[model samples]
Target chain A: MTMVAQTGANTGVQGNKTPDPAKRAASWRAVRRAAITIGLALATYELIARTGSFPRALLPTLPMIVRTLFAMLLDGSMLMHSLYTLYRVLFGFFLAMVVGIPLGILMARFRRVEQFFLPLVSALMPIPSFALVPLFMLWFGIGNLTTIIIVFYAATFPMIFNTWSGVRSVNPLWLRAAGAMGADEHKLFWKVIIPGASPFIITGMRQSFLRAWIAVVGAEMIAASNWGLGWVIFDAKEFLNADIMLASLAVIGFIGFAFERLVFGSLERNTVMRWGMMRSAKS
Target chain B: MPLIEVKDVSLAYDTPAGRVQGVLGATFNMEESEFLCLVGPSGCGKSTLLNIIAGFLTPTGGEILIGGKKVSGHGMDRGVVFQDFAQLFPWRTALGNVAFGLEMKGIGKEEREEIALQQLKLVKLEKFANSYPHHLSGGMQQRVAIARALAYNPAVLLMDEPFAALDAMTRDDMQRLLADVWKTTGKTIIYVTHNVAEAVYLADRVIVMTPHPGTVKAEIPITLPRPRDPLSVEFLDHQKQLLNYLGQGTSKAA
Candidate 1:
């Protein structure tokens, strides 16, 4: 009801406002260690580049990669490619959630739903999205449609399975308690079942998004989409632009990291952790 | 007429090990504003009988009637408190949990919150209304559960070993609190417990049950004064009498 204890919220704020010296010192040390590790790795790679083992075309220097990245960003090509990749992944991921969540709830609640879908889902889950890229291209043609479908296919399984497990694992005691308290079927599902199953549902979303991110890149590469990060990397390979390819790879990695940490992490904190259903590692 | 009637309720189910009779022809009638306790060892179906009264389960053969009407399923007339701490919805605060029944009955938010706060105050947990179930201790959580059950102003309260998980000291305190609440509300309570002392201390009448194909063994009326003393001679005599009934159960099996 949002009427959480004042002491709890106050303590949370106090913890951040007045961090103990020991914790501050420990955190600083971790930052220093990370910086040193990155510096050493980059120095080793620069040394190898100077020695020119294979060729500059095959293995560009760090500066060359950075220059290419900056050039792409300035010309707006990198942003456009990233936007395309983001759109496909988000679209497919949401579609999977819309279809998968209700389906999972149905499967958990009704035996007939499980019987009808279990075998089909089990059979399709093992098949990788990349394997279907060519088949989808032939059917739907090589474009956004094929890539989005592949992403949706890759993401839907985890969403459905995790949601099904979550609903099933909801404590039977809670269900009985709700029932005895005069909650009808509709109220019970919304008030008790959904909240109880939310921890698992959120976990499913996180896992499915990760799968969708991976599937989108692979699908884009194979389907030869003109605008995605995957397509840019694949296209750079043909022109022997090693720096451009590496730059695109870096963008993909950064976006994935941001979504995982910034988006999903905050979501977990706001819902499950706040509800006391889950504990945060840091807290 | 009795406020509640359990007319020869029998529940039998076919397990992989053949037929299992959970409760065989168990029957009882409870008066209005009476404090009744179902006492027995594990698997004696004391809890099962309580579930039947709460309408969580339907007896295979017989029926349970409340207020002269047969109970079809769970209803707002009877409120139930379970032993498990997980019974409270984790996402809701204590006030929210207490107000859940009222919400289901379509009460407005501000009014339900007012009623929930009053219930919490009755249980001496008004200050903790905003606390989540996980943040509360076992005793506190059980108190919140009690508050939640009582919030809807149900005609009857059915509790299944509600204080069994607490420490001895806390259990004693809860018993005293429960007696106070029962006196104030004057609602009929059918409590299930394994602790003989708890039954003797709190119940106006204790119904002792036995394990093998669980059935009611004896019903001993406790006529002790209000705020009954566990160390009192009369109370100890009552406990001893109940113990003998339970012993008869195991002895007959042997």
Candidate 2:
């Protein structure tokens, strides 16, 4: 009986698309459900915190963590830590771009460059950024330099690989067309090759930033920088200041999310997405 | 003297199987304001010949003379319209794509843009001047490509089956537009195509060639009036004549 009913419903939907209003309503409901689900989880966590399954000191409640975060912000310590993390990440990321972009372009454009760099990049790429934290700390000392170097090392490979493939995979027909249209080598590179490879380069930057963000936090934990969200969390572990650790973790996550959504989002808005090499997500 | 002269041009490629010729001992000439089409089956090396004329390829044999000057490499004088409509950089607006050639020549941006807009008008795409290539339809993209190829105002235009990718309706539209562009510009053109109807419609003269070591088989001139009807008796007669030549070329080759 249920099978027959299901078959009848399937037949009803087979020939007709779900109407636009229904689809929009369904999506709106989904958003509402997601918000409700998150609220419920937080409520449950708060309930558990009050019940005290574990010590209040080790497992601080959400409110305590929020208060800690607010107090730290008021004192400007949180801001300073965030700034330190941001500075290190940006500097190292810039270094990666400086080395990776030109190297990638050369590798793609010239056979000799590819022959030299490919093996080197392949060998260096597989070693995780955390694996290099000790080595980098040894070389650069335990501070911003070590953290920044780790970020650079983590970020550079993706940038290079993406740019290399992007340039190489550009439409050959466009090259010939541009060449036949009387474009010189310099003109061709700027006009055709660069724009052609930009979408991939942008993607490379996004991925590189993501990896660098992860690497910076881990490097800070190991290298124990005087200031940074990562260092705060690590420092909090000693005092059993779970509230401070949670607060710092929140800040780190927020920064990563903000950079991914806002910074790279606008970069994409201005470049490849605007150019139609990439499609916009929302209808 | 002819505006462009081809003297026994040939290209050979070396493979594991040894030497293979792309085009062999092909000699032709184009007078100023002439509309010539290279028509044959696939692999006839018509495109190769067009590329050589465009100076994208240097022929292993013979010389291509433009205004009695030996062709060395690609130059602005030869504007090529590829079969795939490889105009309009994806990153640029329609106007920007057209302006690319002028910009390369070191023309000021404002001046080049004005000229680009003019060429866009020539292709009836001035309204879409700011639109990227992806936003435009395939037909529109080809029109923009034509506009770009002409914006630089090349002395000779080399087209390699520019309409082959379009739908039948769009193809006809393109052919009419191309004919108008040709009559207006009076620039020498060397077009390559496999379609007999296309060559018959747009060209002043058609050169048919055979495949497998490509060479011209026949040169047939169509003296039909402007806006030639595809269904007309005279048009069908020319098509028949070209078909016969194509069949004969195949049989003789076999």
Candidate 3:
């Protein structure tokens, strides 16, 4: 009877099994949500257009924004500005990573270093990057340097904070296991600490990239010697070219979304998900 | 010389309230190739003692010697199987995880892979050589962890309730598999568990410890034959005796 009951239970579990149905349902839900949201947004726009409360000069139609975006693309100004902005963000992002990861590791491993940096990090973290734009412009004279400095300023804190937390949050058991296995300091850091902290570091990098991108736009608007997306928007604002301004804004949002989806999404999928650090929320 | 020796060892950790003693003046010795089980109530510092032997912690007092040399910290000579599911590195395959210790020791890749395969075969996990830890079940993961530790061919293998996480049938299977491996390798093992039947079934000598400033309370030799039946009268008697000892310890604490 016991053996039969066990067999019955096992068969029940086997029969009930379905592979990743939750993931399939989640994806379907997302598609449905997107369709509804986009449909409602278009209907609202049409309603506002018919009412004529929305001025063509101040808030151009979606079609006008698209047309303006296409024109800018054809003229090559959008590409040039995009490339400039990309250069500043990437350079500043890499700079923050190089400094932040090592500094975070130092802070995590050593008590004295953590104590010394705690005050400084706490003081600097709350100050927004926009506040540093004027100082950077004064120091570097309103060029790419000022914009890059602003991006760096915006990117550094999140990276530092996330990296430090990642390092600190590593399972103590892993460290103990490593130590029990005769892992040296170098091996411990590389094999255990770094791999353990990778998810948080990647998360930090993603956040820092977003912040730096915003800072670049803000800095470019304030210090407009360089041709960038922010500069295009600023120029359009002065000329009262609503289409161009809306087009630039659309391009910014699209690029930001694309970066998040294409770059960081793949990184998370390939590293954390593959390593079992995270379960797929889609499921 | 004894394979491993603990002389009046005591350990304490500093809590927010104050220093709390974990283990107190525990002494024991194990010969080479002996299977020793350390059994005690929960929070009696069985895990703490295991950690001290594994060189992951230092005792606040007393001394430990492995092959006549004082243990200072962790070394490759002592391999440990942690109680919790300490899966192999997620990034590495089963073969890679088992071969990691060898890789750290600078063994050639080909030789390490061959040895890793052999170890996996010993644990009946050869088919999972390329699988990641997450891809395997809890029992399979623990098997892989065991294979990884055994692949190094360490002088002593320390396990802290290695089978505590598995289902009953899986646990029984693991216990038998472990016995088979021990028979083949004859590696000195110090296993920690709270189960009396398991302790009697596996260990050459079962060392029981008391709680509240934990210390060794009794060491009983298992004279029962190998591949002993769980329902045997002798096994039941030993289990009853161990239970009595445990009950007395608890009552005293209360």
Candidate 4:
């Protein structure tokens, strides 16, 4: 929606030109540059593998890794592992969202809540989620329970921190204006406070998802479940199946990239971008 | 009863250094549909007084009555337009922001939008109803703020230097637009400003407040006709009187 005015202005400036052709050329330039960089990197890797500087079993060529990835997908084992991992991550992320958001809003609104939670969040935040994995494994036992808990632990802190600051940082002027317009406590929270604080809260969600993704992979590797991409990579390492390991790594990277671009990107486009609180990078 | 009556209202608050008196014994009365202005130098507490009457802040002493009822807290009857435009919600379209007060008043969605669009038309920005606040110019944004404040049909509108941020040409245009709106709406306006010329141009009566526990020094009635030229001799005389009143306060402080 924010782009509507800008789009009109651009078309007017271009006059007779369709606008799409020039825009398409600029995007094509970016794609060609990226393709050349990727091609060069792949060629270097293939050259190094051929020279045999390291064990071929330890460092599989890019073609071998791609083949392994295709084979696993055909057999459906990779899909199953991915589904199991997604289930754990989503569950843990959901739990974090449920707890962190309300807790943060409460902390911002009330002095007592802030006093109670601030010190606790600070002390606990410094301890990494992976450090808690060994302890959680001891407590919850290996498998889905430990993995999910670790993801939850990783995701919760950023959610709380961002939301707390978001609510606090709400423009005082808007709050005053709303109050002046007859907004009661309930109306103030819903109309002014929530929308005003939304940018920070959305940023917090993005961060929480990123943390959850990383935590799930690491926890799956250490907690070694029967089915997970991380587990497959670690298991493949023991058998010197470098190709399998590399394939899983590529899948992990692809999934992370997809969530970041497709999910959070669209979320941003719909909310803050439309609101004019944030502009998309190119525009 | 006068539309608004302020009887010896005062306010004090504590800062890190010590206690500060925001206002003291600020007394006045505004008749129905009266255009009143509070003018003084910085630290004069004119805005604080306006805030108190708006019921956004409680007076630590005395009382304020609106339509002869003692003001308790912010209500639907008294709408406030703030300096800095206090920002229209960036997410909401101009129509949505204007409709906000109606929404709080619990008007149905369609009905509120209808009223909001009408108010937008009043401000002459009807075409920008779908535009977000950021997309509009500063002057347009302030017009939307005014439309929003006026949407719920408040008896009196409280303004805190509403044109302070605009450029001189835009500010002048806004003042005339506001004066026209005031005539048609017939809403009692308690406008706060530091500009002496502005006080003479728009106000029916100027309450020249003295600083350091800001209180009204004198109330000068503007007998000048509407569409009164700011450059006219009579207008200049009124401006001179306001300047002297303000000068008395600062010179006394010195």
**Tens digit per residue, CA lDDT, model 2, B1-254:** 99998899899888898887889989888899999999988888999998888888889999999999999999898888887854558899999999988998889999999999999999999999999898899999989998998899998888888889999999999899999988888878888988888888988999988788988888899999988999999998888888888884323432
DockQ of 1: 0.73
How do the residues B14-120 of candidate 3 rate in per-residue lDDT, one tens digit apiece?
99989888999999999999999999889889989998888878899999999999998888899888777754677678898888788778789999999999999
| Candidates arranged by lDDT, highest first | 1, 4, 2, 3
Instruction: Summing lDDT over every window of 10 consecutive residues in candidate 4 chain A, give the lowest-scoring window.
Output: A8-17
- Per-model TM values vs. the true structure: 0.92, 0.92, 0.90, 0.92
Which candidate achieves the best lDDT against the true structure? 1
Q: What is the C-alpha RMSD of each candidate to the true structure, in Å?
A: 5.2, 6.7, 7.4, 5.0
Model 1: fraction of the reference interface contacts it also forms? 0.86
lDDT of 1 by residue, B152-212 (tens): 9999999999998899999999999999999999999999999898999999999999988
Selected candidate, larger DockQ, 1 vs 3:
1
lDDT string for model 4 (B1-254, tens) is 78899999999999997988989998999899999999998888999999898888999999999999999888889888988854788989999999999988899999999999999999999999999888899999999999999999999899999999999999999999999999999999999998888888899999989887788899999999999899999988788778888884334432
DockQ of 3: 0.55
Cα miss at B52, model 4 (Å)? 0.6
Model 4 CA deviation exceeding 4 Å by range: A1-27, A280-283, B248-254
Q: Which segments of candidate 1 are over 4 A away from where they belong? A: A1-39, A281-283, B248-254
Candidate 3 lDDT by residue in tens digits, A1-283: 1322322232222121247786556556766876899889977975776577867878777787788899989999899999998888888888988988899889989999999997999999889999988887788887688888889888888888888999998888777766666678899899888988988887787888888988989999988664999988887877789889888888899898788766876777677667777554322
The local distance difference test score of each candidate is: 0.88, 0.86, 0.84, 0.87
User: Clash pairs of candidate 2?
Assistant: none
